[model samples]
Target chain A: MAINRLFRWITFSYLLFFSLASVASDELEELVEDLEYEIEDLIEQIDERNKRFKINGFLSAGASYSDSTVPLESTDLLDEVNFSPEAVLGLQLEFKLNDKSKVVTQLVGRGKTDFDIVAEWGYFAYKVTPALTFRAGRLRIPLFLLSDYLEVGYAYPWVRPSAEVYDLAELFSSQDGMDILYNFSVGSVDTQLQLGGGTLARTSPSYGGLTFKATDMITMAALANYKSWTLNANVATVDFVADITGTLLGDADNTFTSNGAGEIKFDHLDILYYSVGAAFDNGVWMFQAEAIDTAYENRPGPQIFPIQRAHYISIARRFNRVTPYFLFAQNRTVSASDRREADAILAQAGVSPFDLARVFTQLLDHTQSSWALGINYSLSPKAKLKFEWKLIGSTKGTVGDFEDFAAFTSILGGQDALDGTNVYNLVFDVVF
Target chain B: MINKINSLAITALLIASPTLVLADLVVVVHPDNSVSSITDADISRIFLKKTDSFPDKNKATPIDQKEGNPLRDAFYSKVTKKDAAQLNSYWSRLIFTGKGTPPKVVRNDKKVKSLISKNADHIGYIDSASVDDTVKVVFTLK
Candidate 1:
């Protein structure tokens, strides 16, 4: 219901602005000239405050195909080709109050979300000194190297970042937060440290949509750049309360006892996530690697509390306008003790044999590895085209992160538990 | 008449080839600026918004030429070791992430010079052929 209201508000705002712009179209040219003059006059009148404003936007459209007939988790990844999974558009506005202060806002619409506009970030910043800055309001959680600009497709070379590493933790990307950033130089190396604290309340589109409210979220990050090499390290922790609306576990009786109608609740869920990464780019060759670890604890249900560790390494070489890249990523989940405890409890609850099997399968640790080969071509200064072929394989388990245990086992049709999937994607991304 | 036209074409090609092969870009600042010389790394850091002030602690405001200008392309390639497209990609990350913004853009070298001359801390780049007394050349890329 809240999502609906937000969507309607954004739509109304856009419509009202367009209507007003159209009504004033005849006088727009003259009005623009007069506005410029007025701006100059105002600048002179308010000499102490220098103000500037800018607007920018990005768009991405793509089609993807997977060689599996069964859908992957709740995502729209099916056997045939599809366009709705990856297309997105975003707009950003910045109002510079002066050299030391500014406000920024960004809105994004995605095909997967039925083109509903969502506010991605809105924040105010003030520079305390050349070496220190402060920001407050809604901002991205700086968990990964690409977290700051993950939705801006034109900012990265690949059509998408490595999902194995980035999606290891089901955490909100943005929160109502305050952060302090400090930048300094040690000899010839540039270094930066960011410390933040925040709270989050959002409905994430994972697991058919899960609404979570988290508090006391704290984060710390450090980065260093020397010559052509850059390194980054980050850590974050949060305590959350979630109401699971989707059937994550195929059998609800074995998983959780609902407090009310469709209210599968978990309180005081604590999570910790950390990552370290390094990148090297020298105009011709580029290489990047990152390792992420996630742990979930303090849950009051038979759900799997996976302790996930994931990593990826990518290398690319540029030949003028074309770049060819290769990536390898893997994720491993450890939940043996958690699953054993859940199995004993469910057995004591007198669960049926078939339901017991399903619950145990869902609790097993899932592991998967993926490899991708792609090429990026620069069409222009603002546009790029990318094509990638990826292969994902699992050993001793179903593909982790791609599908829940019940969905994966159902797709297997009693075949071998190991599975392999092939996917291909072509995308064009631009920013203006 | 055909030979006369062929000679004219050859003359035009000869005139254009040198401009393409020998385009020199020079970074400029106001004449009153305290700093006289700058390293390529310093120039990159300034333009990329890594620092807001010069080594002398004076606030710096970098300016840029409009996209697709040859001088702009040459400047980035020589100073930052990045092409125009790469720079655009870099700026997209910074701008959308609210980390920093690209420099203010002007139409031509004359405007760059004019802006630089009006502010002692302002910095810009232009074709070496346009160098004049109004602006001081801090760094040159050939």
Candidate 2:
């Protein structure tokens, strides 16, 4: 009796909403679940086929060759120039609601390093009228063209996207949310207007407190893909909640220090994320590149500046399924040592002469640059292979630090040149 | 052995029977529809939610066969260059993520025929052999 009541309530609610909002005259969005078998039957008759769950993915393994003479702090590091293979396998179960919508769940296992149960994505949607559609649930942020299809390996011509643009932490961002996307034509270009915002809450040691409520984190993004030229822009702000135990206890001392006033000086960091890029893809050869940057701003002046700036350029050629591509990227960050470029700012704050001298010394030895190169080969619609090499260099910055640390600590100096390392990787990817 | 023979006989008869042939899926429109010819790409666009409208002025809505329907698979693959499993995963990424969905589906040939005949702005595909005088056939499965 309860089951019947629940079903009845759902039917009533569906009918109530359908009657008020439906534009297709039939108010048939609710028929999605009811028409599944018929869809399968028609498809079977026309194409002569049936349905079954499927599984597919790829494997990756790599190693690296680094210039050990350089310092890891300033440049990218590599212990050795060698080979290590990394592999991942993904399986998907798909349910078709009709020709337009489907329910799919994909599980991917990344070898070694990282493992977790991720929803990847899930939701329900439909278009009742040409001008309006409905979608609700956890979804991908369509800030970029690839945002909708980021996980499907065959969608792009790269083994792994360039870290410069792809690793911006803000682009692949997703959480529980809803959106309404409307399409209209501008002159000869077809455009889509996607307006959406959602709340993403996650708990980790990186943030203090109990990983509690941190809502109102807003994200707004848009994209324009006309012909071969595609451009995207997006902005989002996320607040970090207190994970005091993790931060304070995990610090050098497990106690909070105050200036004798019983008032705590805690760090609350908020990120201001923005990015824009454009690419051209018109069959044959394709040329693409993107520049992405993030500005980290803190509440107080004591906050650190990341000084991270990166971008990459790539070219690809597709001769049927055997498309080969090449990419190059360089990224760097300037650490805040209170003496790098704001010496006057710190000096004005009334710092002792001794600390000011120390700041100058710290500035002489900061990070320089990190970079990478890659090659990707698309073997087929379902599979591909990729090879990459990276070289990160730092001289004036790390050499001084290594020399100073060598002078202070005999152990690191007693060993060898306390500097850099290398890493190499290969990957196999696919879709089912 | 006798049972196997009987099953084969039934299967064979089912495939050859005219009664089981069903009806042609007409590419339809309102009787006063203005567009002339629609390329396969255009039809795919309409059904895949890539593009909407008759290129004249009428607002358009796509009608689909049910999910996992063999006919739906054939049509999608013919245009989208994707297999059945791939399409399933594609829609999952969209629908579950609340991005987009396929078209609303009609049950069988009879239901599709009725829906298309009643709505001029609606377009759908059915078995070519099932075409009748009551509906207009805009395109055929080549």
Candidate 3:
């Protein structure tokens, strides 16, 4: 598989780099001794210089058990207690060439990716001025406030960010791109502005094993901080494309496949996403909330592109080393008209009764909400242990993001419809 | 004899209270640096790496005391409005994102003074009792 090959390549590259660094350090040690330099001072100098090029990382392992099955392609939520859903190890290396220029790279191995190493970020940054910076190469898409460090579990209070809000935009977290950032102050208010453009592609089983590609992806963000409060607004637009092959659609459409297996191709599908968020953290009490709206246009075939909206609010109060938090999140799809049009198209195509029902369910507008209560206990400055219990409820339609309603019903042998489920998670996160 | 012992204990408690409540922490820069005084917010910004330059437009290189030092904890809580653990978490975000790095760390007040004496742009903090001509006190957090 391509993922297996990529994993092997990354492992080999890390070994090669380590071997070369060891040899170089040995040679430098001999030279320092030969010159009769003060060994202690020379060693300190070497350490000081090495500190400029820093390496840091984080590891998170979590186990989750849900009361009912939320089944999807390739994975199910209620397969007993499982750890693969939220287990990852990330390593970051930053090389500062000078005061104004640096290179940074982060590699992450995730259980969901079959433990394959993937490059999360690799970028070059240059400081144009004290307040202005430019970065190029692969970078995180600033779609949400926590987009930059979404995978770094130790950076946030939750075992995971709310699935209702996070999973909807999870497909496009990174882009091969360039961005400009500027930080300035206006009357005691610290403000930052970022503009970026890039290309991105990812394949996900949530979307029926289809590969989504976007071109000319543009993003902009503005952030302002005053005292203990921070506010952020973000907007992004992209031209998306995807090819739906017969293998992906499977036997769901047997009549259409009989006529020489045609592929469903969508080109120049435009998508726009906008979000605004605010956070208040004053060392004791913390509050965060965000609302996002996503719109899609220009879809071909019987596919219905819906306008999706999501919001989440979380509050936590610190008590010494322990913090308990509460979160409420909701997601909805607004596409009743589009769903009716898709149903009409399927009916005119002479689709079978079972296949037509499946397609119709996939296009239906759905709503889901979740309420979570959690506690975070700091084991140390760099480590934390968290426990969370969440209750999720959904309407009868297709529960689109992490759990699909159709799949849940199918897993239940079509005897019972899934309306709600409880999930429990325990996680250990550390940064080094 | 019991009264005499109680009187001695009271004197000890009175002496220790001032050290806990009045540990004078002073921010310092090189003696040659033109920045004579800085606001508490500016000191916090410089130490947190929110702003890279000082008020006088010179490049600023902030230094920090080694971890576990009382002076370090006091400085962060008073100026940055964060505890040591909170500061660590804050820096972790910046470090992992490649946005900024934490300041260089020295062992004690003597090393802080030594480092500041060599670099005009260097900034550090020390106990007020350790203030010397080698470093200029820019802001005092007491």
Fnat per candidate: 0.67, 0.04, 0.43
Q: After TM-score superposition, what is the CA distance of residue A187 in candidate 1 from its true location, in Å?
A: 3.0
Highest TM-score scorer: 3
In candidate 3, stretches whose alpha carbon ends up further than 4 angstroms from where it belongs are A1-44, A72-75, A247-265, A298-303, A344-353, A356-358, A361-364, A400-402, A405-417, B1-22, B32-36, B55-58
Instruction: Residues B71-138, candidate 2: write the lDDT tens digits.
Output: 66566666555554445534544443334556766765555666667777787776665466545677
| TM-score of candidate 2 versus the correct structure, residues matched by position | 0.59
Q: Which stretches of candidate 1 lie over 4 Å from their true place?
A: A1-51, A205-208, A244-265, A297-303, A344-350, A356-364, A416-418, B1-19
Backbone clashes, each candidate? 0, 52, 0
* C-alpha lDDT of residue A95 in model 2: 56
Which parts of model 2 are misplaced by more than 4 Å?
A: A1-86, A91-106, A113-115, A124-136, A141-145, A170-172, A203-214, A242-268, A296-298, A305-307, A334-375, A393-424, B1-33, B37-49, B57-142
DockQ of each: 0.36, 0.12, 0.24
- Mark the 10 consecutive residues where model 3 chain B has the least summed lDDT: B14-23
lDDT by residue (B63-124, candidate 3, tens digit) is: 99888677888888888888866787788878888877899887667778878998999999
> Higher DockQ: candidate 1 or 2?
1
Tens digits of per-residue lDDT, candidate 3, A1-432, equal 434544555576557556654566566445434432233334446667777788899999989887765542223567489888789899999988898999999999987778899999899999998889999999988878788888788888898877677766777788999999999876557788999999998886754687779899999999887777889999998998776555434344343334322213456878889999999988889999999999876654444445788999999998978999999998888766655655555567776545634453354465777789999998988898999998776645455444554554453365433456777889999999
Q: Give the per-residue lDDT of model 1 (tens digit) for A1-432.
A: 434544555576557556654655546545544544444434434432333777899999999988776565424677888998789999998888888999999999988888899889899999998789999999888888898998788888887888888776546688898999999876557788999999998876655566789998998999888777889999999898777544453345325342111112456777888999999988789999999987777655444545788999999999999999999988887765655565565566665535734354353466778899999999998999999998877645554655565455554567543357788899999998
Query: What TM-score results for chain B in every one of the models?
Result: 0.83, 0.72, 0.84
Residue A130 displacement in candidate 2 (angstroms)? 4.8
- TM-score per candidate, in order? 0.82, 0.59, 0.82
- The 10-residue segment of model 3 chain A with minimum total lDDT is A255-264
